[model samples]
Structures are given as C-alpha cells and as structure tokens.
Target: MTALPLTEAARGATPTSSRVAAVTRLHLARRINVLVVPLIITAVVFVVTIVIQVAIQRATAGGSTAADYAAGARLNPAIAWAQTGYFVALGVSTVASTFPLAASLGTTRRDFALGTTLAHLLTSLYLTAVFTALLGLELLTDHWFGGFYVFDVGLLGAGDPATFAATIAVSSLLCLSIGSVFGAAWLRFGPRGPLAISLATVLVLAVVLLVAVPSFDALTTAFRPWWLVVGAAALIVLSVGGTFAFLRRASVR
Candidate 1:
C-alpha cells in the first residue's frame, strides 16, 4: 500500500472481528498488485496465445488439418500454468512488504494472519471467477469462434466449469499461502529464514522420493485425485499456520 492509514483500534475493547476486518482492508488497500496486474496478465497471455496459434495455423495449413491444430493446442498445457509464476511473486511481496507496516499500525499478529488469509480467499475467488467466466465463454463460443482455445483446454478444466473453478481456487490459495509463509519467514528470521525453509523442503522431498520410489508404481496406481486434494489442503494449512507461528514469535522488523 502506498500510504496505509493506521486503522488500529482506539483502545478499550475493540471487537476481534473489527480488528481482523481492518487487517483485511489494509492488505487489499492496494488492489493494483493483487487484482489489476493479474487481469492485465490475462489479457496479454490471451492475445499472445491467439496470435501465436493463428500464425502457426497459417504456416502449417498445407500439412495439418483442424484436428491437428486442436491436438497441438491441447499439447501445450504449460500455458495454463504460466500465470502461476506471477501469483507466486505476488504472494511473497504481499506479506513481506505489509507485515512491518501492519505491526506499526498496532495490528496484532493474530489479526494480521486472519485478515491476510481472508484477503487471499477473496482474491482467489475473484480471479477464479474471472477465469471460470472466460472458460464458460470459450465453451459457449465453441472455443473462441471455433479454432482457438485458451481456458477450455484440458489443463484448465477443459470445459468443465466446476473443475475449472475448483482448480483455480485451490491453486491460487496454494500459491499465495506458500509464498506468504516464506515472506513470514523472512520477516521473522531475516534472509536465512527462507534459505532454511528451502533446504528443509528439499530434504523432505528427497526423503519422500527415496521412500516412495520403490512402491512408486503401486502408489501411482492406487493414487486418486482426492489424494492430491487432501495433500494440497494439508499444505495450505501448514503454510498459513507456519506464517502465524513465525509472526507470533518474531518481532516486526
């Protein structure tokens, strides 16, 4: 936020709900970073995707049929995840830059955590709604007037609006929560905090791979989408709780 007006409770006994709402407002005060930029990115990605695909369609017209072009579009699933990089960077900056200012405004750690999480929820919902709507339109138009696909591809729910919304919501919060934890780590323990987290994460992943590699086939066969949902849910909780734990113990610097 350019210049956050301190909205701390006056004194006596401010309700917990009010304090939390204040924090949420503080976080969302600067909507450009969390809101506008993503929309811009969407526009840019959409336009560029269409341009490149159209160019390819023209270039390969002699050899490839419409089926081939559609198949090729589905093959490039990476585009669906491209916005993830932006979200991750946004997540880190959101908490890292705001926490000290929030504390100076007399916002308690508990309030900050709750408020920031609410902001994350709202943001994820908003962005997901945008994408879901776009997906709906893409389906309605039969893949953008037929022969183009942006949100209707498999990587982005492939015309399934419910799955699309669910996927976007979870992924958005996952990105923000994960980044916020690292941001909180930096606030709590300085530069080494994120470093430590990185090392620990790497170690855990390595150990899991080592243990699971032997039964990888069996596990893969038995695995279900719900398992991934459960894992993601756990990770989201861990990240948010980690942020709170870090902020609770560390002084705002």
Candidate 2:
C-alpha cells in the first residue's frame, strides 16, 4: 500500500477536539484494570476485616452467644488508600507509555496533557460517586455485613455525606495530580530525577517534622473542609502546571 503524503495525512488528521478525546479515551481504556481490580480487592478486604472483627467479638463475649457483637463495631477505611496507589501508577504509566506514543502519532503535547488531566478528573469523579453510593447504602442498611464500618471511619465519616464525597473527590484529584508530577519528572529527567526529587522531599519533610512537632496538633485541628478544598486545589494546579511545563520540552524516547 502506498503511504499518503505528509501533507495529505496532516489534512486528514483528526480534529483537535476529537484528538484530545481520543487521547483521553485511550488512556482510560488502558487503565481500566488498574481502576477496577484494586476496588474489587478492597471490597473483599473490607468484608474479610468485618468477619475477623466479628469473630473476635464473639470469642471475647464469654459464652454469651446472644450478645450483640455488631454493636459498636468499627473498621478503618484504609482499604480506600489503594485508590491512591492506583492513581499514582496510572499517572506514571500514562506518561511513560502514552505520552511518547501520542507524540509520535502527531498529537501535540498540549492536547495530550489536557486529555490526561481530563481522564484523571473523570476517573476521580467516577470513583467518588461509587464510594459515596456505597457509603450511603451502608448507612441505609445500618452498616451492612455485621455492622462493619468500612466507609465510615476517621475523617472520612466525620462530616455529612455530601462533605465526605466532596473530600474524597478532591483528595483523589490531588493524588492523581501529585502522581502525574512525579511521572513528568521521570519523563523529563529520567529515573535519577525522580529519585533526587523524592530524596529532597523526604529530607524537607523530616526537617519540618522535627522542627514543628509541637504544632502538629494545631495543624490537625485546623484541617477543616474549606482548608482541605483550598489545599487540594492548589496542589492540583501546581502538579498539572508542572507536568505541562515538563511535557512542553519533553522528548519521546
């Protein structure tokens, strides 16, 4: 088959909006496993945790078989943290793989970055919706599955349902953005760059922890919804902006 001329291929190229959408679609498609498998595992872990907790409660009841073991049951919602790692991997893999491929296919860096950001946003929103719905169902069922507290624990269960969902969504976006920033660092400066950045961040954090240990309680107390939202937005802006800046000069290797 004869290849089309460069000019002809350019003229027949996908429209700008379609190109961006395609990038987003492709990224999402490639990440479906990462997006889904973790959640399923998380749900299984939650159920298992509930079972273990119930068994312990029953054993400790001292021959009282009719004791209400489900009462006062609580389980940490740490399984949700799996979503954080998933997003981080998603960000890194998308940049490591898709960025170069898209660039080679004549897609501009701007469109690629925009599409990636859009994909992250959509993924975060979808996860948030699922989480919120599950939480609502848990509450409606009076903490289903032996009254285990999977979604209702710590700050996640502190506020009203709307506040909880908003917090989750914002935090998810922030996590995705931070992951993308790390991925971009790797893309721009290779493996050494990310290692250096990680070391610097750890050093800075250690210093802060040592110097400000006494004020940690105050900081924790002041972490209200408004402040969290503001901080998450700021981090998202910084991460996305940094990724874009890096990609503008990034070479496909």
Candidate 3:
C-alpha cells in the first residue's frame, strides 16, 4: 500500500503556535547579543576596575599603619563605584541596540520592546550579583576599603548589616529601571533616540544640581533623599508604558 504523504500532516500544522514559537526563539536569540555580551563586558570592566583599585590601594598603604590603610583603602571603592555608571550605560545601550535588530527581523513592535526591557532587567540582576559577590569578598578578606561601603570584619558585629542590604536592594532596582528605559529607547530609536533621551536627562539633572547646590547655604543639601529612587521609578514606568503605547500606535508585522 502507498504511504500517506508527509505534506498532508505538515500542511495541517498550526500556524499560530508555530509563529509564537518562532517569536520566542527569535527573542532569545536577539537577547544573547543585546544582553549577554554587554553584561559580560560590564563584568569584565568591573573586574578590571576592582583589580586596579585594589592595586592602587595596596600601593598607597602597602606599609602604612592599619588606620591609615583603612582610610586610604576605603576611598578606592567609593571612587570605583562612582565610575560604575559607565558599565551601567554600556549594559543599557547593549540591550537598547537590539530593538533595531528586532525590527529588522520583522518581529512585532511589542515583542521587540518587551524583549529589550527584559534584557535590561536581566543585566541589572547580573550586575547586582557581581556587586554582592564583591562586597562579600571584601568583608571576608578584611579588606578595609571604604569606597564600597563593605563590611569590616572587625565592625561586622557592630555595624548595621540591614543598611547595606537595603542599599543594595535599592540600588539594584534603580539600575534596572534606569537601564531598561535608556536601553529600550536606544534600541527603538537608534542613536538619535538615545542622544535625545540622554540630553534631556542630563539637562534635567544639571538643573537639579545647579538649583540644589546653590541652595545648600542653609545647612541643607539639595540631593533629595528619594531622588534617585523616584527618578528610576518614573523611568521604568514610562519605558514600559511608552513602549506599549508605541507598539499599539504602530503597525507591526
């Protein structure tokens, strides 16, 4: 007897289900380039910075008194941590760059936006893990580097661990929110989009800085306690909301 044609079963395959699977695969594939590579680069940068800062601290306090070493070492992590904004920017931009690729691949706008946002969230988690590991190492090694706000073995019993934990928790959320919006915008709108957003952010920040600094003549600081948190929250909310709105407004394939 003649065998049934394979084409008949193939023709009966569900298109919608296949399309969803295809979209998922495509999202994952795009994510590797947009998220993983950038996160790796950020991690590498963090390692290099840590090494350099540690070396600098060692050189400065290689033969100094314990108190002197502690003081000197403490400054390095603080400085290095400040410079971490560069890695954050890189991670965000990497995720953002994926938008154009998604669009090029004929993925729906919503999927593209959501993918970009998810990539940022993943990268933020990665960074948070790295920071935590670094902090733990510092504490374990009795490294008295003040810049990073690490636990001092001697002070571990005396100091407030809750503060450190809370700080990390807050910082991680801030990074994720900021990175998500920045990266998504870059991906969706190319270089111009990032430029516009960056410029606007800078302008607003500059104004705040100028306004706040000059007003500190009364024993008060202009740095709002919740400024970073609130700003991050706004960015995250706007990014998600705007992305969805944009997708809805646009005609997707």
How do the predictions measure up, each by TM-score? 0.91, 0.82, 0.57
Give all candidates' CA lDDT scores: 0.82, 0.74, 0.51
Give the lDDT of residue 157 in candidate 3.
21
What is the C-alpha lDDT profile of model 2 across 1-253, one tens digit per residue?
Answer: 1111224366357566776787788777765454776578668877787787678766776644433443334335565675677777777777767787777666778878988899889888987888888788878887774656777655575425987788788888887788887887888888876787789879988998998788989888876758767867987998899889888877788
Q: Compare the candidates by lDDT and give the number of the best one.
A: 1
- How would the candidate models be sorted by TM-score, starting from the highest? 1, 2, 3
lDDT of 3 by residue, 76-124 (tens): 3432354246545644643445445545554555554555455445545
Clash count for each candidate, listed in order shown: 0, 0, 6
Name the better of 1 and 2 by lDDT: 1
Q: What TM-score would you give candidate 3 relative to the actual structure?
A: 0.57
> Which sequence of candidate numbers ranks them by lDDT, best first?
1, 2, 3
> Which runs in model 3 stand beyond 4 Å of their true positions?
1-64, 78-96, 100-107, 144-191, 218-227, 239-253
Stretches of model 2 off by over 4 angstroms after superposition: 1-15, 62-75, 214-223
Question: What is candidate 1's CA lDDT for residue 30?
Answer: 81
